[model samples]
Target: MRPPTRLARAGGALLLAAALSGSLGGCLSAYLGTAPEENSPTAPPSAPPGPRTTAPTGAAAVTAAVTVTIGNFLFQPANFTVRPGGTVTVVNGDTVEHTLTAQDRTFGTPPIAPGASATFTAPAQRGDYAYLCTFHHFMRGILTVA
Candidate 1:
């Protein structure tokens, strides 16, 4: 067969470049933690792979003084109550950095790296405070200070 024409060679180069760019884009997104995981809130819930916490059985057993676990892009014990101005511990169990920020600016924690932890004091006021992860807004929880 005759050698490929100039147009054919250019087309092949363009196709190769497009494929390389697409693959690089995917790698970058994964590295930046922008790629959605299977357990993301937008997807149907699946059994998380790890030890799980059981809900308290009685009202008296309920306690917000426990540590908040972040994994699978979710906040375990998504709602709880604590004493006013009480310090709350947040554990980042996911593979990405996360922040627990109050919607009303009452309380928040700086970015907690994966497997790291941080703490923030609850507002002294008695009310329900909604919070979310600054990096992943869909990951939300409620803090009640009573």
Candidate 2:
């Protein structure tokens, strides 16, 4: 093609690329948890991957069995009430890796492999603990100690 025509074609291609990038950036931002609308209260949050709180006595003092399963980017139960001295075992049921990390200086299990399990003892006090998968920051849960 003539030099002038080729230059015009190249300019048109560059403009198309810029437009595509701008639109794609917005979609990528939403996927990366940067969307204010997603965090808004009007949007009901998903259930945590497991219970946030554990009993004081762990599972032994409770009448019901307490087991939390982690898998498929979610925590089963997502929330639980436990005694102060309770013990909670986290079961990693997902094919991918996950962690039972807790804030507030509470106990935590190491990164768990699929089909592996980790147990943590509850503190001798009532409080709430939030946890999530380290790899997938969006996966979350809470343990409520009573």
Candidate 3:
């Protein structure tokens, strides 16, 4: 065959080989369940177990405090459940100011001073109440009265 014709044939063979190799590689990967390097080998550990509460010893049982920490513009216990008419003392340990305003019946503290504490008694009904820090819109929490 002429030089030009031979060169064209060689180029076509190389192209066909490259295409076959790519398709075979894809099929092999799918069969082996091999993922890219970034894919984690195993699912990351789940979040630590739920919040742990210290049971009241003696008189403390009568007056239990469900502390809702406020820091980094977040409520540590973003969601919590409490017995109706129970007492919830929200302590603001953050350096910034925070407020706990109830969505409905004004069942919240005025502005809990930073490094200071304030308490609010739940109503006599069962419902989910959302609270937030008016000063910082991002700070929010939920109180499930049961």
Number of the top-ranking candidate, with TM-score as the measure: 1
| Best model number under lDDT | 1
Pairs clashing within candidate 3: none
How does model 1 score by TM-score? 0.57
Task: Give the worst 10-residue stretch by lDDT in candidate 2.
Answer: 56-65
User: lDDT by residue for model 3 over 35-123, one digit each (tens)?
Assistant: 54555668555577998897653443433347777777788788876777888877788887788778664698879888888888887
What digit string (tens of lDDT, one per residue) describes model 2 on residues 99-124? Answer: 87776547677888999998887666
Task: Give the winner by TM-score: 1 or 3.
Answer: 1
Query: Residue 114 CA error for candidate 2 (Å)?
Result: 0.6
lDDT of 3 at 28: 93
Candidate 2 segments whose C-alpha is farther than 4 A from its true place? 1-65
Q: lDDT (0-100) at residue 51 of candidate 1?
A: 78
| lDDT (CA) per prediction | 0.86, 0.77, 0.77
Candidate 3 error regions (>4 Å)? 1-64
Q: Rank the candidates by lDDT, best first.
A: 1, 2, 3
How are the candidates ranked when ordered by TM-score, highest leading?
1, 3, 2
Provide the clashing-pair count of each candidate structure.
0, 23, 0
Error of 1 at 122 (Å): 0.8
